[model samples]
Target chain A: MDFSAVRSVAVLPFHDLVGDTRAADRVRDTYMGMLLATRAVYVLPSGEVNRGIARASIRNPQQPTTDEIVKLKKELGVDAVITGVLREYGKVRSGSAEANMISLSLQMSETQTGSTIWSGSSTKGGISLADRMLGTGGRPMNDVTVQVINDLLDQLFE
Target chain B: MICSTSCSNRFLLLPLALLVVLLLGGCAGLEHTTVSSSGNTDLPARLEEGALYALLPIENLSASRAPLAELDMQLRNALKERGIRLLEPERLETFMREQRMRSRGGINLTQSRALRDLGVAGVFITALETWREGEVPRVSLIMRLVQSGDEPEILWIDGVGRTGDEAPGLLGLGLVKDVRQLTAGALERLLDSFVAARSGAEPGTAAQKKRHQPKYRYRAADFDPAAEYRVAVIPFLNVDTREHAGRIVGLHVVRQLQRYGNLKVLEPGLVREALLSQRMIMQEGPSLEAAELLAAADVLGADLVVSGRVFAYEGDAGESKVDFSLQIFSGIEPQVIWTSHSYGGGDDGVYFFDRGRVPSAHELAGRLAEAAIGDFAQ
Candidate 1:
């Protein structure tokens, strides 16, 4: 349960389960930014991670397998790899025309054994009373995203 | 008080039943309305579609992202169907993911670097105004193409809108459909412009489009567009009611000039910096006497200064209106080289609203920007 040795981590592409690849990418990024802001670990440069993905010749970057993580660790020289699945990201509407829904889950795994060290999931950014009454919708995805990431990281870091 | 069975609860039952009926009957009045977005562009022919192109995320202005997200996917499929080769979305998303994290959500060097790494010929950026599903559908999409590199240069742009020809609903019971058919129809016509430009063929969808042309006037008759000059466009003196109208219009003018691929337009940031160094706020309109312009231009290392004012900008989902004036000053002499005044609005809010000509504020702004540039930009 100790992440004391987790000095460095690299965030990989998240699986876009709901067919919205952009939402998946966006949510994964918020997670990465939150992780970086923690100053908890030396997050490997995104450029290096991109290069590692390319070097590994991963056909489906969305679902990075254990071997790919091992390869990324070797190339990027990171201790752990961060990856996640985006179950549901984007909006649901009842003629309101507002994006007030988001859902995602993430995890950080040990590279050598591909064993999960820490994991977190969140389903936030939903409609509220004010949204329906005013027809204005709920909080923007960005703000809600920060809250979601904070919740996830708190579970992992604490 | 908690009602035991039927005595006190009878009163609550009536109100609850009424509420349910009201909610159910609310949609009975759902009237079907047709909204169209007509778009045509002057994009040149002879594009290399087989070469690599990158599609950035579309800017969703309609407060919701799901519809636009679907539109983005539809656009990719549509363009691919039209024989355009796009950089794999996974790789592009990967690059952007890093860019977001490293730049902390700002436009940074990563886009340029990613463009280089991907070895793309062009980048496709777009804005989705209205995309939804129903018997009577609405769609407005504007696409902007920029030639790739460190400094991505604008190549083409156009805004379009169109309404689905759906039959009237029986007491609001029917709405044709959503997503599949509506998106297919819109994307078919929308992406066709890319091919139309290259094949030198007229687009069938653009048949109803009404093109607008803006005129120009210059104070200095001898000012030449052929001259190689670095131009600076200061923030407009916005008299428009819209907040930040001046700043937005200035940016629009810069993009318009940049798209022309002529006239060395200095970065507005550089002009702002120079103005700041002079302890001057360049928010004033073109009335900046030629001497003041010359000083600002000289300090900013420019030969021409473009200044303007956005007098008005009004718009809604149905249509939009704008009025503005523009002027250009020569850095060497205290003389105004050129000036222009123009205004425009979509033909909307009429009995034939469906058949009328209505352009968005952005499209109208583009028209004004073109007029602002006039001969100089070309």
Candidate 2:
């Protein structure tokens, strides 16, 4: 697959399958940073696309179709679209710290071809300050999310 | 041989008719009946020692990618730790399978019947939304208690929690982490309210013992209608940007408190008058001096004063998002008797400006008010 041609990308608001506002925010920020790192690509604002998708009720789907994806791409005006699903959002109590975990899968598709070019997923865990304050080393949710986003971007950009 | 065959057919027909009559008689006997005894039997009134509750799988209303199972488990564990008896999930699963029940969805009536048949005193059901926004994970959970044999009476509690900005490390780490944190926090609040109602103790009571009595211990007749209890509702502060949100929320609190039917609800017009006479606007914060405010209607003699803050409101987008906390104070001295917080929202923003979305909020308020009244009666 020729990745160089995918210079202009549109980021969709990460759909929260888990409905956790915090996890959604983390994924959005991480994806924003990853897109920004790709200087060659022009990324559209996710909020605008999300608003349009929501207004049209196309973001929520039992099974999204190719035509729907293509339409969304045309409406949002982007050559490629980055979409992902949030799989999990939770915390585990370790020794003395609580380890928060978040998992996501990202899929990039070419609007014209209607074909998925790249797909990958990552899960990251972090410890909170409360856990560290209690002398327990735990990974915070934010740290793990950043790492996962970086890894996913490296795979796609490389 | 012809006569013998005819006789055999008659015999079979007679038996069939008899069987049909017996079946019809049995059906007729199943009519609703009530039993009354002239005198109360001295069969040692056994106090209900403890209640066993079964929490069914919570229906996921948000996106499908969320870890809903883990969140349900977390809530179950939180309730179990409070010394409340909970039915094991595996057992529940086996029982549900035996009953040919596949999903918790559309099982509201069936579930109530099953719990009653199982002889459980209470059943807990929940609905959850787990979603990610930006780098933060948000979880919205609504838990309710349906008493056995009580068709319409339900106690509801709703809560929302968010995880700090972070991502998942493993295949299901993020979902699990967010679910656990959010469910745990919600369970804590719910258990606290449940325990408080059961023991008639205020929050932070360490030595309270579980009361082994039925929920409806006090009847409406037990309250003295002649005794007028002065009640006041302070202006609920609005944390959200919605204008007049505080007044609307405050009115709701006042309405719920008045519904007790035992006490006279002070008119909203009179309350406004009292505030004006005191040179106080609704913009002012809650007042602790019940005596000063009572000059209009004997505030010092008030049995309870309800006050709270509106932390959020339904936006113009139709999302039913709202957060409010309430506290019931006893006497003019302002001693806290009971306190509760409720949060509600949805993704489509359709919950706001919609009466249907308000049901969840109303249920929570009713439960909280019931608890408050239970304390006063005790």
Candidate 3:
């Protein structure tokens, strides 16, 4: 339940609810990049995480067992793991030409215990009454995803 | 008292007459068609009320956005109503991720072991042929109920294709079914069919009593009939001069083996991924070395590993010939359990004055695949 001692974190691949893997990957990268910008917790790069996965020869990287977690701890030397599922993501079109939306759930867990310390999710990007009346669109998918990640991180920090 | 003998005939034909009139009235758009093939009726007895079964990712052939998840949810709800246990979606997802099996893809060997450890009876894999939602809703699905075993038996295989339904009329006058009614009705009917089969037939039926077990083609002493088994089919060794011949044949064999319902066939992707992870490069050969086969079985947790190789493939624009051989190796030990060599001729061989008919590579591979493992049905 403590984030003070969580100096470094590895974000695992997020499951794609919309089945658009490219969008999911982009969102995860955006989150990691934004988290890195805060300079609060040093984030492991996805490439490094992938190398660790290949090194561990994990059967299921997303659903790692306590034993697999132990291996990952030794292999990647990460204090915490951030896992997520992308629910609604990618570009959406409304009365306005094109808009983007993102709905995602995330959990940060200690690698040693695989115990969750914090969890959160958000759905963003919809046509407001103003936008509907003016015939305008909301932010693009990346911008919306970044905003959601930022807000969620703010909550975690608080 | 007033009915004559000829009058009785008129009454007998009344129902048929109504059906014809209904067809003429454009009621033909909604007669649901179902095709099913069932193995031993006793096979259903394997499903217990509370036994948990994993559902492999449903193969989505329809051009829809991840409807498999929604459809699977509906299916699980239907199953729950029947007191059937299913693997929790998250649990299955996590387990597959652990084993590196793709949700939209396959069942691997090691993943099968995990399912067993989780105390699952078997796995359900389906294919969505058509899933159109709207005014004229249509749903077509091919369902496979596979038993967990060394050769996982596909106990029940059913296919349904239906679009809307006729609305019920007063006194059988109107035959109309709404989209919601059609979907729910078809789903319930399919579930009932599965449950009834699993509940078992009356033990005293003549078919059950006769019990005609056909002669198996590749009989080896190690072919244990008692315990359920999962089989991992590694990419076949390609020996033909043509490229990807073995892979094509392997694909056909996997498809055919999948239809049998007695073997928990490992998805080819899982096998490929496993081999790649283990740094074991699958080469073009008739069979794997004992150690290599053991490694494959280790990764797949399969009881048996089916290895194959293509020997001959020759074809031009219109004619083709193919030959292939297969061998089953046990994961328990470093030995071949069974072996079969087969060959087949393909293409119509119709001669055109300038251009003769030629079989494509896939056509040849399919023929060879059928020839090699056709007896597996028995």
Candidate 4:
């Protein structure tokens, strides 16, 4: 589980369990934004990663197998690979109170050994005290998403 | 030591008059709509400013069969005005014809490879999602810039939705009376945002976010006081449209329904999976036989199923409008328990001026869904 030697990582598109087809790309993009801000790891550009995916014909980029992970590492020239699943993304309500919510989990694996190194999940933003008292409807989706990724990154660095 | 009655009355009236003036002043502004830009703001840094670009034929998703040639023309002019380089119109036309390119709004890798042959650096694609004509026009336009190479990638994607009366200034001077003006304004705003983002300005520079307030209402009888309800929202059926209007509206409804603490709304993916497993198809419309509804509810472990159709979702002018209806069925009895229809513009609740206008069909749909599902919270 030592993360000292990890350098560049390719973040594949997150699998979306939310019915909205657009959620996957949106969530992945937001995650990348926050991840890039951390300066903890060098991430491969999404364009190159997507090109590699198409070249390899990886059918399920969200759940790449070990063989596919190795192939992606060879194709994208990255030391590590990251994949994720978006369990929830959008709005939720508790009685009359409403707020934006997102639930997602991520896993990172070393490309050479094809061994899972780090894993984390985050769920945040739902009917906060402010939403209940002041009826503010909580933070916007973008803000909530930022917070979620921040939480996951915090866990990763810790 | 006593002041005259007239003097005391004058003093009181002056403050009241100022208060009235201040309130009215808040409502007195030009009609304007805010554009929210997301996606890769870092695109500009990677793009060569002087590189030649190509504009794909605009995609029209509006219900109106209006000719989009004028809009395309305007787009070309707008791009040129911003000093963005583009291929010659005639050359571009001939290339599209020769290549037999029918695609719009997006450019794939193959297309990008082909465009690269012409020494194009990037491709600009636009979609006109809503175009309505009336006293207050509404228009929604989405534009994307994709770099053309072995790996075609979207550099920037932004959308602007505006209604003609979005910001009627003092005495209504700011109302966008013409669709052309609204369209031009939207394009300008989008390009400005892109430029600002590339120039290292605040990428999140967006208009003030306004919260949706309930302006309309439809009340159902009542839920059993003691019994908790499980709700399932299914895919909405689209009528006379090529757009994914149905799914968009359904998501809005799901978002609104989840705001209630008493209802356990099932994830839509599970509902879709259950339907697929049972091989249930409601292709014609969302209407289902009572038995079919009950079967779906049973598999989803829900007490109610929500389904509907999108009739009209237009925002191509100055006032965006959404028209859709939803019906709820009882899981146990296959009986219809609630039905509601919503059809209105983004400017529905604006009183004095444009302060409360919505300006986008997406946001308006969310608010309307909130109104239709308002009774659930009670």
Candidate 5:
């Protein structure tokens, strides 16, 4: 989590395990917007990063090889890259109860060493006690998503 | 006892019938009507009604998991009802499987040739853009007819988007509660236009839907208006929160480009096929990079390439907002020829009580796109 060597980062598209085809892009977009707003680290424009990825001919976007990582850095002029996976992101139901949920993990790797510099995971939202007691639908999906992303960012910068 | 029971039942039904009649009469002013209309009805003259046609699988571009199978069936039935000869479903399915055609949303030149060999004259490519079923239902469907020949050219294309509560009568009881009925009404209107065009009725005149002189626009000074340029529209980058906003905007731009007589707009499916084959991915959004633009133009055989970004396409509480920018690059050289930025809300010009307010984001996007490309026609 050292910030000395990491000046810029490329956030790859998150992998979605959820059945929804759009979950990956939607979550990644939110992450990009929030991460950029923090202004903690210089983030490459998604278009530039994608161009680098395409130019490198990386077969797997979320899991680029070490050599591909170096190539992406050379192409995009970024010091580090971030990859993420969305394990569960949507509404979950248990019998008669339903609530929004998000489970995600992210890792940052420096291009020079091509090794993971920092990694974090976050999971939030479910059928809560208050939700059940009041018979409410729980938090909106966007709220849960933002909360999970915020938790991860806090860990990343800690 | 039986006679007494029958008499009681009749007495009960008479009052209920009377009540129904009274309510209907009272709510007559509030009758809701399904409004479905299309743009661009000028179909190719060579298209014959007797020619056999096949409906490719309807593409579901909507965020909602609309019943695509039901829609396909409905379209097939509607085609049959209109006396249009369709290829046998089993035969078409077999051909699709044999050819390993993964994308039925569009037909490439090779597929078109193969269909021609199979005695099919044309193919229908349909995309269900929007389908929301609830208290107020909304449906948007776009259909295109491509001739199955050496060159797979789009013969006719039109789309219709409608919301259930688009027109509420006196009591609001006229609201359409069922999505299927709304879809049917839209389909009926689309077919009517197609039928009318085929029967030699003059295609509806192009009406000016939206007009705005762009504040930021660039056009090449030496641009020729009569140039026969082949154009390919890339999927616009969706930076908006709305799902599929990029594709929707791109489609609207394509529709606008198709209206220009000097430009030959390439089928989006073919453009997609080329992009995939070339392994060119616009990951972030539209890129103005010289190398990539030239590569795309060469691969797609496009004289001009169009790319764009959608910043906003959202509708909340009956107000619609759309913001986007479009850039057209020359294929011969990796340089921009035309660029324009457009942004507006549904109530932009509405002063009085919502007389000119746009009802949905889809329509607003269409108008913005039209206004952005308005100068091109001149």
Candidate 6:
């Protein structure tokens, strides 16, 4: 893998299918780890992308369209826009939380052409620490996010 | 030889008599005989496995309609009789309260979590819709199945049973009877759809299905608790006539988020502080620059922002109802991580705040909180 070729990767806020704000945070948090792990890729801070999205006046930020994604990538001047969708999330029991069954669909495109070079999606589910203390049980949110991100990254890097 | 033959013949007679007596005794011990009764033998069991369901209090959405509460009770009982585990309305209400959540007009995350907790595979929400055709009476129903981890599928069943003139002609059937029949029909159809879906049959695939999935998790195993993230809860949009209803709902939700003691709750005060710091007015509705709000909260810098609205507050002359709709967005990109709507209803008909209904506002609040927490479970 040519690590030097990938630089300044931008992670767009993941789209929330259910519209719960917490799920979006979980996704961003999970993605942060992956970004940090990839030494070659310079990841843009999620906060910056969020601010840009908020400024864009888009409804349902978690589920933006391809066009909106293109516009965001251009505005941010990043190599790629990492987007995701929260497929399912919640605490099935009092403390046991299922954070994300993220359908992580990443589109790596030439920012100029808006043509997708690579796109892939993966479903992942996890439990939260609060859920564990509450005695509820499920997969951890981070685990799900990491797995989804890894799958997405593989598609993009490959 | 003659004596031996005579003895053997006596012994044979005694044994035959004994055998007859035993046979007669067995016959006498037999209870009532069951003759085959012919009926609807093919009728399926009322309750099926992996069927998620919701039992809603029937509401009269028509003029001069029958009380829906009674129908609600009856329908619940009927479903119970058929071996269905009816989602305890009281329990569901409690869970909602503990979570400090209110119902959005439709099935919210709280209900989904509660149902899932109850081991229900799906939910059946029943509502009454009534209208008049000239002087004749007409009644109908809108039933919806909120499947766990799937899209919301709705079914509308309608009809006219009897008019006032036809009512008298029938064998002592009244308005209640007519309404009950209509409800029974709606319930039957609801169950039919459930069974059909489980059996992998499509029931009106043309109808639009609304897919609702959760956005985030709160457990440590899911994410590092130490990982700092900024959550934004936008001012709830009110779909009701009540002023400040959105603020009330928003405050309650923010309080619940803080209670979780895990994720950092972006306080309304902080939102105000950030807005003021940015020299922007913290007013009604989502900020024109949502990104600014995200940045002010440091959400862009943090992890996620939560935002949504108070979509509806319905009440009659005596009772008050409140509904809140919410969504969590990624602070990085303001993506909605999760979404939920909760509702709270109370009877305020008689007593003032000091001596209100037996289930006082505090109790109602508690119930709403349970729902809020339970929604996460669902």
Q: Please give the CA lDDT of all the candidate structures.
A: 0.59, 0.51, 0.59, 0.68, 0.72, 0.46
Kindly list the per-residue Cα lDDT of model 4 for residues A1-158, writing each as its tens digit. 56778877888988889987556665665565356545566555454577678767899988999999888878877799999989998889888889999999999989897779999999998888889988878876756776888899989988
lDDT of 3 by residue, A1-158 (tens): 45889988888888888977656665675676567646677666454577677678877776666677667788889898888888887677664555678888898878888777889988788666666677657664545766788788887798
Candidates' chain B TM-scores in the order shown: 0.58, 0.39, 0.49, 0.60, 0.83, 0.34
- Fnat of each candidate: 0.00, 0.00, 0.00, 0.00, 0.20, 0.00
Residue pairs in candidate 5 whose N, alpha carbon or C atoms collide under 3 angstroms: B29-B170, B30-B169, B30-B170, B30-B171, B32-B174
Which tens-of-lDDT digit does each residue in B1-378 have in candidate 3? 457977998987998887666554443222213323233456556666678887776677544544666677778888789887788889988877776775443454455566778888778777664455665455555566666644344555444445442322234344323445555666776676676667774211111111111111244554664456576677666652355455545655665555444666665646665666667654422222433443453565767777765655544222345655566666665444555555544323333221222223333344444444444434
Q: What tens-digit string does per-residue lDDT give for candidate 2 at B253-341?
A: 55344434355444433354455556764332343343235533332235655555565554323233555555445444433333444
Which of the numbered candidates is closest to the native, going by highest lDDT? 5
**Predicted structure with the largest TM-score when compared to the true one:** 5
* Steric clash count of candidate 5: 5
Residue B235 deviation, candidate 2, in Å?
30
Top-scoring candidate (DockQ): 5
User: Candidate 2 lDDT, tens digit per residue, A1-158?
Assistant: 56888766766657687866545644664465345534556554333455445544674532345676677666665687777888877676656667777788888888886678899998777566766687545554545665777778777867
After superposing all C-alphas onto the true structure, candidate 5 shows an RMSD in angstroms of 12.1
Order candidates by TM-score, high to low.
5, 4, 1, 3, 2, 6
Write model 6 residue lDDT over A33-80, tens digit each, in one string.
Answer: 355445445555454565566656656555566677667666666665
Total backbone clashes of model 2?
62
Q: Which whole-number lDDT from 0 to 100 does residue B246 have in model 1?
A: 63
Candidate 6 lDDT score relative to the true structure: 0.46
Model 2 chain B: which ten-residue window has the lowest total lDDT? B31-40
Writing each residue's lDDT as its tens digit, candidate 6 over B1-378 gives 999999999999998987665544333211111111111112133335635456655534433446667767876776675556666788756655774543322344445555567676655555443323333333334343344433221221111112222222223232233434544654564454444433444323111112111122231124333455555555555543355445444544443443332455443434543444566433223322454455543332335555445544433222334444454445444333344444444432323221223112212322343345334423
TM-score of chain A of 3: 0.90
- Candidate 4 residue-wise lDDT, B1-378, digit = tens: 356887999999999987676556444433335555444534557878689999987777665665599888888898888888999989898988876667563554456788899999988877676677778877776666777777565566556667666565555666777887778788898788767655655434233223332222233344462367777778777754337687667656765654454666554445655666668666433332422453453465677778766766766545667766666666655444555456666665577534566767855665567666664455
What's the TM-score of every candidate structure? 0.45, 0.30, 0.38, 0.47, 0.63, 0.28
Candidate 2: misplaced stretches above 4 Å?
A: A1-158, B1-48, B98-110, B150-152, B156-183, B201-378
Q: What's the residue-level lDDT of A129 in candidate 6?
A: 70
Which scores higher on DockQ, 4 or 5?
5
